[model samples]
Target: MFIKECAGYELEKEKSNTSEDFFNRSVVTFIDGSEEKTLHVLYVRYFDEFIQEFTPYQQDPILTKDNIQVTFKDIVALVCLIKNPGLRNRKRLYINSKPEFTSYFQDIDFDKLTDVVLSVKQNNKFELRSPLDYIIQTR
Candidate 1:
């Protein structure tokens, strides 16, 4: 299942764009075998940002369930699920990578033995709706 994780939340693409339409727990597919899901294996797409954004989405039990179709509001509910602990060991932050390393979603990635930050200095910067960006705008 991990091998088939979606790469990221695909906004423009739509399986069922109609309001109140549900697309529970099914892998959104293309005509061919190649699929267009919103998750990526290793979660290495944009490590730090991915971590920050994905953290809130990971612990969501409803959003994480199998084949349950939902609407945009369901996505909001997913954000809410971040704080609710359905499991015995739920927490605000996943605990795997810390020095003690006792976090969930730690194994979400490929279970890489090493926690290395791969760097790629790029010329372009993607605009984001983050607190840092808001601060940069006001100042």
Candidate 2:
């Protein structure tokens, strides 16, 4: 079910130029009867090369999902996700890491996490609400 929706979304991408339109429209129902279809994985191709240059000496790396890896592209999307949770923020919660980190997203707690910024769409602009105020003006 998810695979088909993802495929459809990918196919629609070639026809639509609207940034917000590039998203999966299906919702997932959990065993607890909860429904959610939030932004999950972001595969950024442009920044793949930068992965080799990122040195994680400043702090311990984030705990990623088992068998899951964080690439440079993921980091780039994460940076954007933190800056503007609304940039194609079709997904309910995007960790750039994995969807299982619900605690991290709900708490908005960043003890040793780098590039951790909470953002939202305010007045049609990307308003940074943590660490510092990094205003991103959108057209």
Candidate 3:
């Protein structure tokens, strides 16, 4: 699904079913030829979860409407900035990382989530699909 077409995201969708063992696993190969299992980003389905995850301590009232769209690249970039410390750090935390655990998303345009860009594939294998593999155009 194109980022523009996405109405919103669901975080609970990232959960692993009891029957599925190998889910949301990707082998990312860097320029140096190193590859490893990488955990992709998750879609925040519930707005309350998004608020609680991103603004748990804040006293400010959130008024943003539901179904805010966000791109896959920005989500990954947000992960790199908020969650991962460095290259090795990213790989180490590749398995089952959550967006609510990150802090960078709070500082960026997450409030204006509709401006984000990325494509999502709605199959059993790739739901919150990344913009890699020529799936998304470079901005």
What lDDT would each prediction earn against the true structure? 0.22, 0.29, 0.32
Give the candidate number with the greatest lDDT.
3
Tens digits of per-residue lDDT, candidate 2, 1-139, equal 0110111011135556554433322221111113323344433222233332343323222323344432222233334344444433255433323233222233222332222211111111132334223222344
* Candidates in order: C-alpha RMSD to true structure: 17.2, 13.8, 11.0
* Models ranked on lDDT: 3, 2, 1
Query: In model 2, how many backbone clashes occur?
Result: 4
> Model 1, stretches more than 4 Å misplaced?
1-7, 13-104, 108-139
Residue 37 miss distance in model 1 (angstroms): 14
Model 1, CA-based lDDT = 0.22
How does candidate 2 score on lDDT?
0.29
lDDT of 3 by residue, 55-135 (tens): 422322223224432333224433332233243235433333454444444444443332232222231122223323322
lDDT of 1 by residue, 101-138 (tens): 21322323211100100100121112112212111122
Q: Could you estimate the TM-score for every candidate? A: 0.16, 0.26, 0.28
Please count the clashing residue pairs in each candidate, in the order shown. 14, 4, 7
Candidate achieving the largest TM-score: 3
